[model samples]
Target: MTLATVESGFNGEPAVFTAELKPHRSLGPIGFRVLMGLSVAVTLINVVFFLATNALPVAMFFGLDLALLYGAFWLNYRAARAREIVRLSRNQLDIHKVTPAGFVRKSQYNPFWARFDVARHAEFGITDMAVVERARRTTLGKFLGPEERDSFAKAFTAALADIKRRV
Candidate 1:
C-alpha cells in the first residue's frame, strides 16, 4: 500500500509529512501463481511431446528453462520486500530503508539545513532524487516510477518550505 500522511505537529507546530514508498508490481499474488501454473503446464505438455518423439534431451532442456523462470520470479518477489519510509518534521527529516534481506538503514537531516535535489533527464523526466545536508546526501524512492517520483518531490519540497517558513 502507498501511504502519504501530513499531520500537524504537537503544540501547534508546522505540519509533518510522512510517506511510505514501495515497488509497484503489476501482478498480484494470485495472478503470479496462475501465471506460473499456466507456464509450467504448457512447458510440461511440450516436454512430453518431445519425449514421445525420442527427443529426451529436449525435454530435459525444457525442464531447465522452467527452473530458470521460476528462479527469476522468486527473486523478483523477494526483492519486493524492500521499502522506503520518509518522515519530514519541523526539526528533522528521517529516512528509513529496508532491504529485501531484512537489513535496515536510517538517515537523519536537519529540515532547516537540508536541500531537496532532483535530477532530471530530457526524455525520462526525473531520474533521481535525494536530500542533501551539508556534504551528506541520502537517496530516496529508488523503487518509484518517474511520475510518482515527481509528485513526491513536489510534496516533499512543499513540506520543507512550510517548515522553513514556520521557523
Candidate 2:
C-alpha cells in the first residue's frame, strides 16, 4: 500500500487528512535532489570547457544551458502540482504521487463499496504534500518527500481492513 497526507486551503490553516494508496513506486526526494545536483555539475563542466577553449560562445552556451535548466525545473514543479497519476479499481481510489509523502498506488480499491477509505494523508510540513479523499478523483498533493511513501502504505492497508470490518 501507499501512504500520503492531505490538506486543504492555503491560509496556513486548513483541514488535514491521511491517505493510503494501493501500492506503487515513484521517484522520491533523493531522485529530485540528484537530478538538480547533476544539472549543476554539468554546468560546472561547461564552465571548464569555456575556460580551456577560450571560446566566447561558452557564455551564450551557458546562458542557454541555464535557461533550459530553469525551464526543466519550472515544469517539474508544475508537474509536481498537476497530480500526475491516479487510478481506482474498486470503491476505493488510489492516489498517485500524493505529495508530502510521495505516494504511488499499487493494488486497487472499490470506491463506493469499500467501507473504509483514506480521507487524509501525511502532514504538509516542508513538502506541503497532503492526500485528500474524494468519492471520485480530486486533484491535490503533488510534491513528495522520501520517507512518506512507506508510512502511507501501512496506514492505507489498515484503513482498508477497518473499512471491511465496518461493512
Candidate 3:
C-alpha cells in the first residue's frame, strides 16, 4: 500500500517495480514526429486561409491559439517521455500530474482480489482512458496526450497487473 516516484519513473514498494514502458504501452517515435508535423501543417493552413480572407487580426488570433496549444502538447509529450511511472503495489496507485493551469491526479484501487479494467470514452477517444479500474475506479487523466493514448493504456494496464500481483 505504497506509492513511490523517483524522477519521472516510479517504483512502488508495496509491489516493487523495475521501471520501463511495457509492450502495450510503447509508442513508436515516428508517431510523435507525424503529430508534430501535422500540428504545424494545420496551423499553417489556418494562417493561409485567414490571409486569403484578408483577416489579419483573426489570423493572428488563430496563430496565437495554435501556438499555445502546440506548446501544451510539446510540454506534455516531453513530460511523458522523461518520466516513467512504475507501479509495484496493489493497495493504491496514485498518479499526480502538474500543469501551469493546475494539477491533475489519476489513481486506481486494487482490492485483495479484483480484476483490472480500462474504460474508454467515445468523447475522450478510444486510446485515452476516461476511467481506469482496479477494484473500484477514479477518473484518469483529464488532459492526457491524445496522440499518446495507446502508450498510456498499455502502461496503465501493466501497472494494474503489478498491483494485483503484489496484493
Candidate 4:
C-alpha cells in the first residue's frame, strides 16, 4: 500500500521489485499556468481588436474559446492523476490501480503461481501486459507508453524469475 512497505520488503521477505507507474505529461503545473496566461492574453488582444472593428459577436466568441481551452487543460490534469503501482516480493505480488477520482483497486497473487505476460507486436513492440494466474488475468501498465511498457515488462519478468528461483 505504501512505498515504505515495498522498499522494506513484503512481510519481511526481500523486495524483488516495486514500480509506481504514471502517465507522462509534457507540461508541468507552471507550464500549464504560463500557457493559460498567454492564451488569455492573446484572446483578450483579439477580442479587443474585434470590438474596435465593431464585431461584438467575435469578441464574445474569443472569450468563450479561452474558457473552453481552460476546461480542456483542467480535464487533462485531472486524468494525469491516475497511476498503477506494482510490488513483488518472495511470496506475494501486489498491484494497485488508482483512478484520477481517487478510487483504488488492489489485486494480489502468489509469486510462485503468477506470470508476467506480454503481448508483442513486430512493428509496435509491446502492445499489452498482464499478470496471469491460471484462469485469472489482470491487465497492467495500460497508461504507460510503448517504451515504458517494454522496460517494465523486462524488469518485471526478471524479478518474477528471481522470486521463482528462490522458491
Instruction: Tell me, by TM-score, which candidate is best.
Output: 4
The positional error of residue 98 in candidate 3, measured at the CA in angstroms, is 2.7
lDDT for predicted candidate 3 compared with the true structure: 0.52
Best model number under lDDT: 4
* Model 3 vs. true fold: TM: 0.37
Compute each candidate's TM-score over C-alphas: 0.88, 0.38, 0.37, 0.89
The global C-alpha lDDT for each of the candidates, from Candidate 1 onward, is 0.83, 0.48, 0.52, 0.86
Task: Name the lDDT value of residue 61 in candidate 1.
Answer: 93
lDDT of 4 at 89: 79
Per-residue C-alpha lDDT of model 4 across residues 1-167, encoded as one tens digit per residue: 44334333336666679899999999998999899999999998999999999999999999999999999989988999888888887778988777887667778899899988899999989989999999989999887899999999989999899888885
Task: Give a tens-digit lDDT track for model 1, residues 77-163.
Answer: 888988887887678787877787766677778889999999999999999999998899999888899989999999999988988
lDDT of 2 by residue, 1-167 (tens): 23333222112422122443322336567886797788778877887888788876875688688779768766656555424343333234544444434454332335445333233445633333333334633433333443554465355455545545654
When 2 and 4 are scored with lDDT, the better candidate is 4
- Candidate 2 TM-score, C-alpha based: 0.38
